[model samples]
Target: MKRLVFLLSALTAMSANAQGSKKIKEKDMPAFTQFTYTGNDRIYNDNPLKEGEFYTPVLQGCYPDPSITRKGNDYYLVNSSFAMVPGVPIFHSTDLVNWKQIGHVLDRPSQLKVEESRISGGIYAPDIKYNPNNDTFYMITTQIAGNMGNIVVKTQDPAKGWSDPVKLQFDGIDPSLFFDTDGKAYLVHNDAPPAGTEQYSGHRVIKMWDYDVKNDRVVPGSDRIIVNGGTDITQKPIWIEGPHLYKKDGRYYLMCAEGGTGDWHSEVIFVSDKPTGPFVPASNNPILTQRYFVKDRANKIDWTGHADLVDTPDGKYYAVFLGVRPNEKLRVNTGRETFMLPVDWSGQFPVFENGLVPLKAKIKMPKGATNQTGKNGFMPNGNFKFTDNFSDAKLDYRWIGMRNWRENFVVKGKNSVRINPLEANIKAKSPISGLFYRQQHATFTAETTLQYLPKSEKDLAGIVCYQSETFNYVLGLTKKGKDYYMVLERTEKGASKVIASEKINPGKSVKLKVAAQGDAYTFSYTADNSAYKNLGGTVSGDILSTDVAGGFTGSLIGLYATSGNDIQP
Candidate 1:
């Protein structure tokens, strides 16, 4: 009963930050920080670590649905970029621990048309595999929003660019490419059976097709069902997706994720002698999961699945998969993150039972493993802290926009970035125009000084703590009925509600700030460039989390300017 009372108090405080003191309940009159952080957030490494340990999140932010390849000693990785322009991000590493973003597979506008794509509805999972026989790198993926169903793009040197996409006929999402020791190649994916019937909601079948290298397409009339509705059709293992085929010791192995991507999420495996399987499920399924990680533990790692396996040049096995760290009450704020785990085949089948936490791996450094640092020279971990004066003629490479390009609005000045408000408002579904950076940490303060005081009440320029078009919090200065007011607003499902507002005297500029603590955030502003004052009631970061926003991307902290008056004809 006490816990429930405190929770209600917390909710009251958060709502007050959104709806103002009048809506604030007397039970929560006191301003208190409700959320608690567990502290796994650190973006970069400060010192060189022993070979037994390495920094995680080889690639950070909304880079999900990862695909990896190894060419000789070099390792190449690509993650699904979704609606963001410059689609699939391609990364390179020598040891698979230290990765550098070499380029993006979908760099050309001609290759993909993501105009007005919902944040969640864009590119799906992608598979990056190398064919030594052809000396080429092949990438295949499903377009969630634009283009045809599934497409394959290739490149000889990925650093340069990739060829135009070649459409592949596959009825599924997570498309993967696998080459056999022999000349034969195969493509495996999750799709509804030919009968198009299912026992349960997540009952998707794994289908296989002969991939023709010569024609660069699936062989005509060669679709086969490898595993019928998961390990067993009756038990009905749900969401048996993200299949990766491997051949080892002359046995074909297929590994996949089961249980929808939530608390029940896990990795499972099957083995067969042929490329297409009469496969047998391992007795020990759910090879990787955090469900057993002690729910009440201090460090909580949950939602572990969507994995891709890779073998180092030295024949060592490792896996890169998506995992999440919930902030409070199992509400996730960081979105799904990339985590590394060892493939313990010595056990029954193969599994990483310890779950999502990064382990102290006892492995030799690959031939070309080198430590890479961010622009700030910090080592990589969970928290990525970034600050830019915007003095350069162009925006930093780290900042990304929605459907539009960041270059369109980011103009140069002496020491500041001058942004022209987009004709569209941020509340619109038509991808909002904002220059955003990933909110890598659960708790950090973001502050920006803006010089604009609106000539019209319609000018809205400020710092946005955003998840999607439907979910965001804005703290900026605007004119409310001829009075310059500092307003805090919460936008959910295209509706914007003012939480609090303070009428202030007009100045040359004002500094807006947001401090995140656990799942909650506090917004403040300073017109004098000093003496910050709280602007709104505390707000929940989970509101902007992918779990609430419904997307494959994470939360982004951005500088946005929208002419609320600028509506379409």
Candidate 2:
């Protein structure tokens, strides 16, 4: 009877192993359960489109500073793809809700050096426009930190390919192009005030000058300061930037994103009879914003504006803007995600009544629009669960290393993944052992169990919130002599702030869980896998915009291990 029972148990174990192996394929992974992962929610409902639904981000991994334009019935969108190779990832959509990546605009290395650049310094916001006369597409980006911010690029046919970056001598960032009805092209850009001056030039005025397409330089034309800074209804200084010109109903609408492009700032519109504006704010300024009042709800997420407006083939107008999905639980990976909203015209000005919409499960395409489909190399839904008995030719797409990756980071021990510390300190250069994925949701929980052998006081291992090489947060285990410390390191500036640290008795295995409820996150550790205690809570930094940091990408959550000096596993 005992032998029979043992045989049953062994068979059960084998069955489990086989099932797990089959599910380890990258395609089989589930979507990351972040804010944007609305498993059963519908993208659009029966009601007239609401605020959050239209602009809720479909893709969660760091798509920011969106610039969108319409070509016939098709809508093409591009966002800042900083530091990642093949920058300026272009996406397409028939209905604004369901989006698919078509291709990247900057694919050549000569166009930009993306691999070696820092996270925030590579590319700024890019504007996409279709030349009506020639039916060509143009893209412009600001390469910050490289050439004293004097960088520009253009392409005649972005869908086919992009030309080498035609360097334009510009002083500031956020470069945009305006093609007037008179067959003349103009460049609208922002510039800082003169040296030692407190008043920045671009914030108070939108400078307009002729653009020389052949030479890729701003011509010596009469410069005009169309708009000036002033106090709005809120009586705050209105710093205007991101100027886009549209002529409608024989009136010129000069729309710009305002409020310093942070939380509480918004998309403000102004109108004038002429392209060069002595413009007046729309009676209803700040046409779109997420700043609403609801009791018991925290309005911690800020700066919900910076938009690209497009008109559909049917003459229906829409605006694509950026807003953060604040999870009460703080399990957010979708930071400043893209949202779509219908633009309604009241008399001569534009009005946006719909507020921010939360992400939903599936959204339908616009009528008569064809769906464009493509694979994202990695799984679209970034759920990172896989059983690796380790004998695979390559690591899973879900796994990413810290500074440097090496063969010794993982060891196949029978049918388990054995992770060891590559360096003692988290600050060491290229700690070969770390795995991460883009944070997809604003609210969710991530938990993992780890077994390790600590060899020194500098050894540490656990999960981390990686913004870049400089800014990040770590919640993991650190070793001191024979004891262990559950340490949380917040990296900002050039130093590490240990927010919470708890010592533990020597143990062979530990389970770690990090729960993000909204902007607040809590870390917990358990030795028995039964009851867990909260270590503490921390907030995610405001690092998504072009002001605080310049990049289109968002944050990532992953695993890490560090050895101060010796290699410990």
Candidate 3:
């Protein structure tokens, strides 16, 4: 199996190399000396977090479709990566307030085959569940690319590693595994309506299957539709997805996200007597949503849905879901983020505490625990600064690659990191020689210092603010004739436009910086650590928004190098 995977990867790389993009020798590639990122969003910086209060959106920046599970005192959380290599980032928490990213569930090339897919085509809505019956953990998700449909992978401990994916025999998205106390397992997911029963656009149904745990497959004929058209079939609620099943107090409860994944997104609940049954919608219907809120609100957080629930050892319930914090212009460049709220499952159905109201920027810490944001290696929140000198051989898990991660391009030294230029540029849908970090704040600055002398006009290396293939900004040092120039290029709807350019004599070191103040962005560069000069005065960040880009991911700031440089100024 390992040999087969190697051959497949080699073939894919060969095919990508045949795209007529220029290649360069490894010795002449660019080496980045340092990279620094700082997040200073006004919402986080201005607001004072009182004692015992932490900022919401625990896991920020494009980490959408959150699914969480608890095993005794340990809590494990997983989020959708969507075509990024090493998909399904798994995080661990002991007190729910302080969380740390352990590792990715799909870490190797054999486990994830997404070398040729687009940035948003690989993994979607991964659901992680722990079954005490077998003392195992299962992660199930839909692979939208690579022709790998719904798949499942298991592990005895999440920190060690996960098994190779076991393809499930089912057709749907957002699949979740439910373990009943009776030793029976079940699977629930969002699927299309039955044959010829298609009603309207965005109409979807929730289906359940009797999962055979011994064989790791769904039973042959146990598929049944649990809910049709969301809360009410007659009202025609649309895009009912991200479903999960839970049993409490001798009753089965079904929860799903409804009304699409935009501002109208919401979470609804239903009840049934059996795992697969005639489920009835709860009177409260949408247990969580921000749809009713008026537009043009202050510090707005929108598109709240795709939730999962987990109970603590002491029986306290909490929910984790996805929401977006848009800029003042109502543009979402940070993408769908993960937020948490305590649940009021004390009733017949669960309700997200303050989930229905406008989301608050701060929340009180859970009982007996203090806020741990940015402390003890927990994922940082509010305003923070991160600097990487590339002194360690192992890269941080926050740095990711699109489609596939190539080992040849990255060379980590004692003080710097060199990237062998790839033929594939950022404009192509294929994998490029770039290591990306998601834009975690609405307003932040990313800068990198590199040593590079472009061999020709075909070579370039610098930083990229990438939303997708057609929506991004590339600021790099490229050569024209015999002079070196720093050029900033913008691609909107697949058309490239040169924003600004300036000729410079970068002697030994050149620093490039991309700063964003809400919707406005500026690109600046300095030579030999001299005074910075603005290459692009300021440009609107609308192009980096999902509303304008039409994708399922947030902006990724990357250390990029490519031999096939096409943008010129």
Which candidate number maximizes TM-score? Answer: 3
CA lDDT, every model vs. true structure:
0.70, 0.57, 0.88
Candidates 1 and 2, the one with greater lDDT: 1
Superior candidate under TM-score, 1 versus 3? 3
Off by over 4 Å in 3: 1-27
lDDT of 1 by residue, 1-569 (tens): 66664564455334323321223233211111111122234322233356545555555556677778898878888777677766777777766767766767887766766666887767888889999888899999888766567988998888889998888876788889898877889999998866656777778888899999999999989998888778777887888899999877778889888887887888888999778878999986767877666665544667778888888777777788877666655666667767676666654365663543433312334455554445333225444445576655444555666765544444444366545455566666554556776666666777777776665576667788878878888887777667787778888777778888788874767777788777879998877867989977787776787777776678777777765532111
Task: List all candidate RMSDs to the true structure.
Answer: 11.3, 10.4, 3.6
RMSD of 2: 10.4
Candidate 2, residues 124-143, lDDT tens digits: the string is: 77788876755767888786
TM-score of each candidate?
0.85, 0.67, 0.95
Ordered list by TM-score, greatest first: 3, 1, 2
lDDT digits (tens) for residues 272-337 of candidate 3? 998887889899878899999888999999999999999988898999999999998999999999
